[model samples]
Target: MDETIAEALRIAEESFIASSGPGGQNVNKVATAVQLRLNVFALRLSPPVFGRLKTLAGTRMTSKGEIVLTARNYRTQEANRDDARGRMIQLLEAAHKEPKLRKKSRVNRIGKEKRIKAKKNRGTIKAGRGKVDW
Candidate 1:
């Protein structure tokens, strides 16, 4: 296992529950859905990373700083568990990356002049559509 995933799993709590969906009678009998709760504080992320994670997680994150992820797409417990863990790791990795800074841009003088010229041309074309006087 990768270091990041192992670290994430170390602080994660996993629970299996009866999953709803197309699994025939097996769905009711077997608990296939995996609910993964990861402790955000355990990850020891920087302030910026934590903020980014909070934004990225949205409602999935609890007030106590735990990220909750449920996976029921897979029919088996193992698959669902893996899916949940993978998603949590992916989220953490994404938060670790810094967002690209945006640079302000200004249109050149010639570009602005061309835009104004186009508007005038369009206005003239529309004006030509008016009813002609007898």
Candidate 2:
């Protein structure tokens, strides 16, 4: 019931039907599109899974946090269905993975000291270019 995708793996429903493809003049009449619907809000996924999914899905996630995938590449019904399912699995697996945490690091002391020293030297070099008071 959370925003995570663990709920997706638990409650995923696959519905693959014949696709409408380049099957001659009669292909346009058939329904060949593969629609992969992951009910993200229905399942109780972990916070990490949900976090990953939100990042992976980008703008694909609906306003309510649901993900809808549509596959209509192949002209054949079965091929299109398989392609859609494969893509859905890939997306889900990616979302299931945990991202590595960033480790904090300190600024290099030597680098900082060199920067200050260089600035002072540059100012001295510039001052020597001024006109003499005499």
Candidate 3:
């Protein structure tokens, strides 16, 4: 299905420029890391979607209910930012998906009959294996 940008549900946030762990001058000079944040409670999504987002975000969601995503794999700031935004979009989309309801499953008539027939055959074989007393 096509997805439209959810401007109404959009969240504005900031990201800091920091070094990518232990690297020399290149890493220190270039801020390739991206950190994306969105307050779940502030989102305009339906209640069910917000609840599912809370569960899906797991530890990424803060105690106050904020969804955070960080992307640092890319070398450029723009690329990293896009990656983070894309991930957030995917996460929200997943949360918005309709959940499949569980339907009670009954034993199949054909399979049940086959299983019983096999059991009877196995029982006869076991009976023949019993001690042959007088």
- Each candidate's lDDT (Cα)? 0.90, 0.71, 0.76
Q: Compose the digit string of candidate 2's lDDT tens values, residues 1-134.
A: 22333455446555555455466664557767777777776755678877877788887778877777777777766777678667766787787766688999876999899999999999999999999898
For each candidate in turn, the TM-score is 0.91, 0.62, 0.76
Number of the top-ranking candidate, with lDDT as the measure: 1
lDDT of prediction 2: 0.71
Once superposed on the true structure, which residue ranges of model 3 sit more than 4 Å away at CA?
1-5, 8-10, 21-24, 108-110, 120-134
- In candidate 1, stretches whose alpha carbon ends up further than 4 angstroms from where it belongs are 1-5, 132-134
* Structure candidate 2, residue pairs in collision: 1-43, 1-44, 4-50, 19-32, 19-77, 20-32, 21-75
lDDT of 1 by residue, 25-130 (tens): 9998999999999888887877998999999999999999999999999889999998998899888888888999999999999999999999999999999999
TM-score result, candidate 3: 0.76
**lDDT per residue (tens digit) for residues 44-104 in model 3:** 6778877888889999989977777888876777877888888888888888898999999
**Model 2, which residues run further than 4 Å from truth?**
1-27, 63-65, 116-134
Q: Find the candidate with the highest TM-score and give its number.
A: 1
Clashes of each: 0, 7, 0
